[model samples]
Target: MEILWLSEEDVKGSLSMEGTMEAVEEAFREAGRGTVQMPPKSYLIYKKYDGDLRTMPAYLEEMDATGVKVVNVHPENPGSGLPTVMALVILNSPKTGAPIAVMGGTFLTNMRTGAAGAVAAKYLAKKSSKTVGIVGAGAQGRSQLLGLAEAFDIEAVKVADVSLDRCRALEEESRTFLDATFEISTDIKEVCDADILVTTTPSRKPLVKDDWINEGTHINAIGADAAGKEELDPAILRRAKVVVDDVVQATHSGEVNVPLAEGLIALEDIYATIGEVVAGKVPGRTNEDEITVFDSTGLAIQDVATASRVYRTAVEKGLGIRLPFL
Candidate 1:
């Protein structure tokens, strides 16, 4: 009859980028092994507010983790002095289907998302990756940098954004966790010069052109989580080896969603899933000369896997408040 309730700060305090990467990578491995159950994220759009809410539920059988997360995205929230994205997660006992814990999913979501990007790059990016380029110097961009720094020895970074303030802010913030030097610019093309590139913009149209990107670059397309959203030109996917988090989900709501809808690409064009690459079922970075693209839609399994860990660690360290209501 009692459930643990963790605040946003409590959740952040309980989690680490390193631990999250390990959990997310293992979660993908389980997905590759067919031991996880996850449904595509369901969304409810609020046209008036220019925002959308999503529900994601998943169970990782081998990890003994099951949870549902309710998250919202409102790009204009910053104008009102609030975050564009916020979320909450509820963990339940699989045996009895009882709520065991409730925690803030906003930070957890960001970290897990960053973790997913890093996990994808770990297998797909070249071993000699040293430079990183990123579009959209926002929270997700910063998290992506932090995540990449954990996975690779990045010596230099290039950042592109609409706001110089946000770009500078990311550089200052990154100083705490990342030790790389930075170059800030307003041109997306200028930022694409790197061994590894991460695009985090919520562009409905393509921002990165095919010719601007060179060969041997690994791209993490972090935006474009909806049906019509896209970041890279469809041609980039046509030429590069494309990997998605999930086939069904990515088709409807990932970077490839637009391309697939317009017939610019076909389902068979997808080379493999990230899970398959992590599980060693498929080869990664075959020659270091072919481009690689990781299309991430943010899986429910990732959320549950991270949330489950946070709950256990919080319980051991006495981090959250114990509630008697549920």
Candidate 2:
């Protein structure tokens, strides 16, 4: 069998954040409704190379979309002129168990993650949130900024990174891409002061301080997609109304992985999943003063939903090259 091959450029041109966000929200609702097939991600952590490889698979029951993603996180890749992260997604016919296509997944991964961030913010963040703060001026960092900007009336953006040069570049890049004013800082605390705080770093240590967070700050923790990788102080999680994409996934793979392992918080500490909130089973942001945290481990349902959308859109638009054999 020969499967259709879609390039990174094609995937980039075919899928968009607005559409992905809408589709992913629906996917989450389906997840809450118990119509999705998603198993916890499996990973191979490489301490020698300072990297990790993850395999994520899911089936969107309603959409009949099934796919698996192989992704890697290597913070040192940039020095070798490679991306810090890379991914590949393979879509298959769920009923037939036949391979349908192999598509570029790097961009798909970033977009779905951003969309998940938006979905979380839509429920957990207060309505009046106007400023967005981003930690880690990298791929996920940029996506989180764009995602939050799309959801809220973001007036300004603040970015912080270990490298001042990266922060400055991110400031300029965001100003151009987002068409908004921005500031670069080396202070994580200053960035955390914004109304909506998003952390997307790969650091194993915490960058944010508990005291720096404001009363109503809504934090989207996107960095800790693997075990031991973290960005926020656990104290913030202790006080905030924590919402995860999936408890089973987050406990072993997301920002709460370390915390859960240490016995700091139990499964009951998770206020609700974004899916439950989206499905109206649980209320989001009960009080204006409530500090809410969305711990995103990057669900596979997101990839399935987004990949299905992109695939359908590409097919309709005649965007990709159709292979001869199948």
Candidate 3:
């Protein structure tokens, strides 16, 4: 048996934003229809290093796809010239449980996550949305912009970050891929006021306030993927129509976790999952004046769906190294 090994560059080179969005959307639909089996991610915390490792696994029954992702998050890695997050994925055959591919998942993680945000925005955000606001101008922020640009005709982008350098860098980079005007600021209020807001920070406390957001605004809450992390004011959650990626995962670790834990909101308050909305079981935005939020906790099904695409593309293009493993 041969196992294919794909590097980070190989995955990025093979995947496109548009393709990834479509694949992730399909994955959401499958999940909504209860056709996929994805367990909640298991975590291993290292208090000393202030980081955590997560193991995510999923099986798409209809697609006959199965995969596991091992990922880590260390906020202090950047000072040592490393990324804050890194990941690896192993794709396997469902019938025999044989490993078919081992690939770098860091880039895949960013792309799929971005694709999720884009998919949420497609379903939740208004069709006339033109201005986008991004908080935390990191790699994920750039990926969010890339994915959103593919879905919407964004005319302007407002980026907010603690570090002006990061904000400026994101602004400069946006010029290459996005045909939009970019504004860099440290003011969270300015960022939250856009037609569409994307929160990508690892902030434990809420950076956006309830009053900063206007009616009809759509938010993609992408940063808070672990317990105790939240980016939006719980007050915002109370009034907005919240759509989560996965109910189990989102309640435990997504943007809604904090609010749900504090009793600020109830499970019943969440309107629907993005999958439910995508599957047409629930409506997205009913009116122009309704505020909407998509709480994405990054699903394992997304990993497998995206990895499957990368694997097929690699085979067609003769990429990656095929090594005999058995």
Candidate 4:
């Protein structure tokens, strides 16, 4: 059998933010409609290396797409001139169980995660959202801004990071990439006080305070994908209309995990899944004064949808090299 191999550049060049958001939205709809099978992510913690490996697999029956992603999160990689997150995706044929394509998933992962955040904001954030705040000035932060610009008419951006250099770098990049004015701040509170806020750090404790968040602010809690990691204070979640990507996963590892584990919030505190909101089964942002939060754990179905898009685009453009596999 012949399998196509796509590099990081190939995958990144093949997909666009608009197309990725559309595909990811469809994937969420499929998940809500019970047409997708995505098992919870399996993890192998490497405490010695201060990192972990995750295996995510999913099959979207309606879309006829199946894929698995093996990704790793190493917080210390940045100092060594490496990315904090890297991944590989294997696209397979469900019928014959044959590998159809193999591709780099790091870029795909960032794009899909950003797209999910954008979709959540589109459904939950106020229509007049003009200011965006980003807590972490990393690759995910850049991707989130890119996706949000595609979805909303963002006028200004506030960025906060532990490293002033990273914040400055992000400010420069945003000015060039996004049609918005950029401001760098050392105070996390300043970043949290915007029309829409995105937290993408690997922080173990709450970086955003309860009082810092204003009413009608929509927050995309993109960090805290593992146990013991949280960004926003539990008090914030207690009052906000919390939405999760998946109930099972979110409660165990997503932003809701810490709050639920602490007994500060219950399962009933969660209003609905992003998928349900996308499928139109649940209402989003009922009132302008309501505080909304979308807790994202980065589902496997997102990988499948995005990888499928890259695979199709690569094939159409003849981008990847094809090799025979036994």
How would you encode candidate 2's per-residue C-alpha lDDT over 1-326 as one tens digit per residue?
66777889889988988999988998999999899999898889888998889899999888899999999989899999999878888899999888787789999999999999988999989899888998888888888877777888788888888888988877776776576678888888778878899998887888888999989999999988887877888888899999999999888878888887888778888899999999999999988898999999888899888988888888877787767664
CA lDDT, every model vs. true structure: 0.93, 0.87, 0.93, 0.94
Kindly list the per-residue Cα lDDT of model 3 for residues 47-129, writing each as its tens digit.
99989999999999877899999999999999999999999999999999999999999999999999999999998899999
| lDDT, candidate 1, 1-326, per-residue tens | 89999999999889999999989999999999889999889999998998899999999999988989999988899999998889999999999899999999999989999999998999999989999999999999988998999989999999999998999999999999888889999889998889999999888999999998999999999998888899999999999999999999999999999999999999999999999988889988899899999999999999999999899889889999988974
Candidate 1 stretches with Cα past 4 Å from truth are: none
Superposed by TM-score, candidate 1 places the C-alpha of residue 306 at a distance from the truth, in angstroms, of: 0.2
Q: In candidate 4, what are the lDDT values of residues 1-326, reduced to their tens digit?
A: 79999999999889999999999999999988989999999999999999999999999998899989999999999999999999999999999989999999999999999999999999999999999999999999999999999999999999999888999998888777677888888889878879999999999999999999999999999998999899999999999999999999998899989889989999999999999999999999999999999999999999999999999999999899999998
So what's the TM-score on candidate 2? 0.96
How far out, in Å, is residue 176 in model 2?
A: 3.0
- TM-score, one value per model: 0.99, 0.96, 0.99, 0.99
Candidate 4 at residue 202, lDDT? 94
Minimum summed lDDT over a 10-residue window in model 4 is located at 171-180
Model 1: lDDT to the true structure:
0.93
Clashing pairs in 3: none
Candidate 4, number of clashes? 0
